[model samples]
Target chain A: MYESNRKSSIVNIYLGSMKIAYVLPMTWACGGISAPLSQVNALSTRGHDITVFAPKDGRIDWFPLAAPVQVHCEHPVEEYFDAVVYVGDTFAQHPFSSAGQKFLLLQGKDHLWTAPAKRNELLQGYSDPQYHILVVSGWLADFVHGKCGNPRISIIGNGIDINRFFPAPAPREKFRLLLEGNFPDRNKNVIAAIEIAGRVRQHFPVEVWAMARRFTSAGELVDRVFLDPPSDEIPGIYQQCDALIKTSILEGFGLPHLEAMACGCIPITYASGGVMDFCKHGENSLIAGVGNLPSLLGHVLHFLSDSDLRSQLKDGALATAKLYPWNRVADALERAFAGGIEGKS
Target chain B: MRILAFTRESYPSNYPTSYILMHQSMALEELGHEVHYYQQDKHPLGLTDYLNSFSFDLIFLDLEFLRSNPLLRILSQYRRIEPIHIVGALYSLPAPPGPAWEVVDFTITPWKGETTSGLAAQFDLRYLPLAYSDRLHKRQSASAGSIFVGNTTGNKHKEAGVYLDELIGERSVFCIGPEFTEKYMDPFMLGSLYASSRCLPNFHYSWEKSGDCILNERFWQTARCGIPVNDYSPLMDEVFETGLLEHFCFADTRIWQNRIRNLNSGAETVHPALIQKLDDSLKEHSYKDRMKQLLDWLR
Candidate 1:
């Protein structure tokens, strides 16, 4: 699996136990919220004193977090961390100015959609010399470097919890196709995913299952919809699905496809930048040009029809998942905090 | 004195600026001043020919109007020949106060910040901050959950996030934004929404909060609705009488929720001191006061 490839190649840099404060923009259940929390949990397991500082609503029931969460609530954030890591561009300038080694985690191209003044404020952070830019995908690293002209970037791609998301083989009556993410976001392009599923259903006895945070008009097309299911139950859903289809136009590092791969589900996705890190077209994943519905539908049809191809790709998917264990992600994050991050991937 | 005011006509539903301008015009009219409103679309015309239609003592407009319509340069030249005093309400400017501001005789801002301070240093600027409309904003029986109104169609999805999402799902919170509707609500309907809500959980737009501790016109209007306003800003101290809104205001959402709960239950009602302060500030900061200030400056 990709985990073995990731584990064998990744240089484990131990910078000893360091005090880290993971600054959460909100205590929500999206990839931006989960990625940092997952890293915090993994690092805490490695005996680091990591505390999650959220601006408001500190109770995170979605992800199982090992680190303690401190809701600063209007009060100034504590300034005693060895490294203060901020994710995305939601908060004000210098949120933890006094806190030690500052790192800004670039999750996606979210700033493009914000108000012009606010967008400028977000982009300003990327160019600031005080912040060490850390991104999930290599594409994002290039984005910051090309856009902001900043060379200090580290690519610490998101990790999957193998323990939580592993293959659970079970007899299925019908081939199930899965879709996940917040459908309402225009960037996610859930309508395209639904369209692909509807087209797939016409050819085969396919039951389209969707795990979404919000139900939109496109959601009506999905056969079975799960709204914000707990993290623990996600693997079971992935295991039952034969293929996971994602038609997202943009992704910082598409985590769902990797998680599905870990659960032995073949990923049928678009060339959504971040997914290109692991999703090798016609090998591990069936990746079409972004927004190309015909090619996506063709790949799904071919994968379902050819059992030999399915077996080979499933193995490829498993190998891809083996590369991104949470512990390794935490190891890279520790190096990033210690100012030992290798240059952008 | 005859006053000609230019304001934006096409404001989306519940836009605070629309209500602010409405109240300003109403106050001017109430003060026995002859005020003629020339409402225009977002892309306004200077309408130099239209200006010739009226012989006015003073012309009132937003500072943004000067930046948008270059034809206003004709109006600036007309200002030299005519005995008309041009006043611009400076909420924000795209660029620094430049030659465009030369057309404006006086500048007024409803904010106290470095921006206003810098402008004050360079120009004839007055710190005439936001005030509630007593004629419109009045208390009514409220039973619904806490509410906030802003441009949710934009990046507010990122800003409001879980706090707004959970409230929208769990409570009777009317988190109305542009995403809900594009129709502009009349002042009465807007006031009703404020007064009917249990509380106003005020989250400032990033620009509003950036360096400048400026309170929105919504804050002043909502305060008059007799609902607890859980807001953030050091400007609260500057705007309100000492310790008047401190207990009612919160910088944290947890404490904000507590304040809302306290108001919802019989445990807490609108504090007598805050009500008195709002009443006193209502008259003190009203558009009447603003108009009187403008007249006083013109004299």
Candidate 2:
């Protein structure tokens, strides 16, 4: 079984745990904030002394964490951390003084910055000699290398909680397609999924289902749209749907697709570079080129016609999900931390 | 040659005209030519001032931006001062009569219709079809299916009845129209989409079907992807190998239905000769090829 193999793999890479502190971003019900929180939970389970530093007003209420969250507004934390990993671009802006190996986790590109100067500032921080650059995907590694001219970078992929997300035993009455992510985000490309749904509806009696933080005019197109469902209820939503249509053009590490795969929901996705970290086209999931809505529609149609393919891909999805337990992600992070310690010596 | 190219579409747009500007500019640059891209809306300097700043050998203007009075005045002024060649691309057909045409030296049009060519003959218009960027639109190894990738918002889908859902009934026809998002697909993404599908069901506007040799960019784009383009255009006979286009060409909704069924059933397979011809056609129809021809004409 892959679950046992995944656990063994994690055990094999078990370096002695040390005091690891993760600097958090302002919290929202998004993956950017959740990925680190989930990783911190996994690391604590591995017997690491973990302390989460958060902005004073930042709400860490999206999910429960195993580690104690230290709220630092303007005040500096006087505690010593063995390895402090700074998340997001503002690591330079809010310098937390700590006696430890520092890492700037470059999760995504400077997407919020419209100006070239802001982008250059972010690139400068990536190339900073003090912090070891760690990224979530191979795309980011290439980005930092190409832009920042920093060759030495570690890529630790995001993880899925196999226990939290799993396939349901019962099947739905009607064939349904699940769409994820918020509508306002341009990078998410939610419109592409809606258009594909509109096209697919012409062929079969299918329903469009979506779960998002909020809804816009496009939300009306979905047959059943749930606004910000609890994290525990996400698995049920994924289980009911046959496929998850992810149309994001840019993603550091698209966790929802992975989470959907864990629930035996075949990820019919665009080849948004981050999803490539897990998804193999025609293997575990169907991947088309980003913005290629027709090819993505083709995938959905293929699922409808070919029952054998559906079964095969469902099996492949489950098998792929088993390989990425949170323990493995924790192991990768620990290895990255160990490498930093060895380099210092 | 130092050429000044005019574009109206913003970067990262879904507009076909934007792609034309980008592909042509890229081709011209690759051909060891200096191309200064100028957008009238975005440029800080005025049109006349921008023209004065750069010593351009030629000014390639998209015909839509050809303002009648002011543009003619600027061109007229430049003509007296310097021998600057003014070539304009008529992206859309039925070239309107204007005073701007008086100062224009040559006109380039992608349309091959009687109206377009007749106007071209009347005003020395060249019958140059739109080309695909080989740098972007090339086939990669992938699992294939029948697909249609173009804007459905236009009259083409409406007049031909290709826009209806029944056309895609029970078959794996991938339909992607970015018009829903008010954006155009990225060129690299479009190339990958072309490569993903085994064949593309290309439809043209109803007006384009009437003895008009309006071979849209999809013909070359999908062909460059090394896939069979099941086009509804009768103009394919004038461009591609005869027997080849007959196999891929659909005349009506009934024929389109049969072709789709055949393709889905795996009864229809693109022949080796068809693929070889497609590969050969791509060599002559790339943006670089078009740019080379344009430059040769200037010489």
Candidate 3:
């Protein structure tokens, strides 16, 4: 009788642990989806047993799990997970009827211009009152709420690891400007940056460092372009740069902007999409109008000529970075889950 | 009658085949037919059991699966029991002989015209037109610019990279396919090239291989954004009217360049009308209605 009671107690304790299932499309590689990996890491640390349900061959870290939880391949299976967080639109049609709580974390709507059928499924499927939608930016949240009619949507800005990206002492001599993106195709507005850099170089000694895997020869217009060598050195590059510029046509959330700011580098970015949610013009980062070469160049020049402005922006950026620490973000996520689960109950 | 539609399972990355099957199944259910989905991984259908189970009124099988599986032989065994609808990229590919002769009742090919009759003779097929879900219809009504859809890599024979590189330089081109692999291709570079234009090209394609058909969804959504599509397949014309899409035929450099120029310049083109005609023909014989008709014929 005592043995049976002990076994029952152990089973109850095992069952009591909150089982959270995360469904991410791909692994971290500097795209919009990569921004959430830090949060996933933070959430895992909080004792909320987490299992990431993703593609069998995806590069996501599965070793962090305490014990082997059910990581079912490519199918919706009934599990004891208390919450399911889907990181992309691929799981938009996934049946959440079995899960305790369903949440969608959208980084960006990549195929929004196309794939109406999939978008409709996502919008309709998530419209269920039981599901909670969390977007990285207000634009994304508003779009989802308005299009899908889901009232429980929340805008949870992406959090960065402040420790990984905290400010380094300003480098002496030639001002270093870093531009990093996984895909630095025409849209990183790399060409425009190059053009602006060229204009700025005539006045000041400017050196541009680009961290990207796929850099077209066409982008050779820039003087000092560096291709991404490996993943480990990304933090070092961020630490070395004086300012980071993100001129993408649109971003779900600019992680590099936050990462650069965390490292105490001044951020010069376009005022668009999720960047506006955090980057206030002249406060934390210099905001330039999208695709405006003159304005983008103007921001770059202001930081280059005025050391005091750069110093102020650096301080402001590092200060702002504190607000979006991974710990705080994880706590907010836990709160969201608690509120959602409690409300549903 | 109860029907079971099967495809690959859902994942975080969007797979186009899964999307297509979901829409088709939903459409079938909406037409007052019972539909159940048996995914590849969830509950894999073995040949004998799949043939024996519940006696479905109809079964729609993706051609890619037929190529990959030995189930086609089992399908041939029960060719007389009920209607089997074969859907997917069926352009001169080797499939099981028995199923080709007797198992497949009707075939839905992405390619158009008497191409159906040829496929029928070889695989005992009947041509069926493609149809989009109501979701696509709504997206089309709201679209603003041209949405170009195609993979960076061409199918087994064609080279999509060559055409894609040239096309990327000129117009706003968004890519939807598998994730960017170093060995395979980079989807992000493709996306950035497309998003470079004033129009914020959204990259919403799933890198997941769940087998959902995102092509149709992308077509309608692109249309919703008022983005005319510069697609590679002739099949798109059949599913969406010429009024809905801007079609492009793949060819060598010079021909492709001319077509791109004509499309960009908004010149009078026969391609648009041809697509519209194809759409009109398909509208008259919708895939859902046709599938029902074929099943009834078998009954």
User: Interface RMSD (C-alpha) of each candidate?
Assistant: 24.8, 13.2, 22.6
Where is model 1 more than 4 Å wrong at Cα?
A: A1-13, A90-94, A218-220, A340-345, B1-299
All candidates: TM-score of chain A: 0.91, 0.92, 0.85
The model with the greatest DockQ is 2
Each predicted complex: what DockQ? 0.01, 0.05, 0.01
Across A15-126, the per-residue lDDT of candidate 3 in tens digits comes to 2347777776665465454555666677777667777665555654422333233344545566666888887764553444477888877776554433568756666655
Question: lDDT of candidate 3?
Answer: 0.55
Q: Model 1, B151-205: lDDT tens per residue?
A: 4233245556534555565553566666544323344356667888777766565
Docking class of 1: incorrect
Q: Name the regions of candidate 3 deviating beyond 4 angstroms.
A: A1-17, A61-74, A93-97, A125-130, A182-187, A223-229, B1-299
lDDT of 1 at B276: 73
lDDT of 1 at A7: 44
When sorted by DockQ, best at the front, the candidate numbers are 2, 3, 1
lDDT for residue B195 in candidate 3, whole number 0-100 = 31
Worst 10 residues of 3 chain A by lDDT: A1-10
> Residue A17 in model 1: shift from native, Å?
1.7
Backbone clashes, each candidate: 9, 2, 45
> Residue A34 of candidate 1: its Cα lDDT?
88
TM-score for predicted model 3 compared with the true structure: 0.49
Relative to the real complex, the DockQ score for model 1 comes to 0.01
Residue-level lDDT of model 1, residues A115-206, one tens digit each, is 77987888888888777887888767767776677776777889987878899888888888998877766667777788778777767888
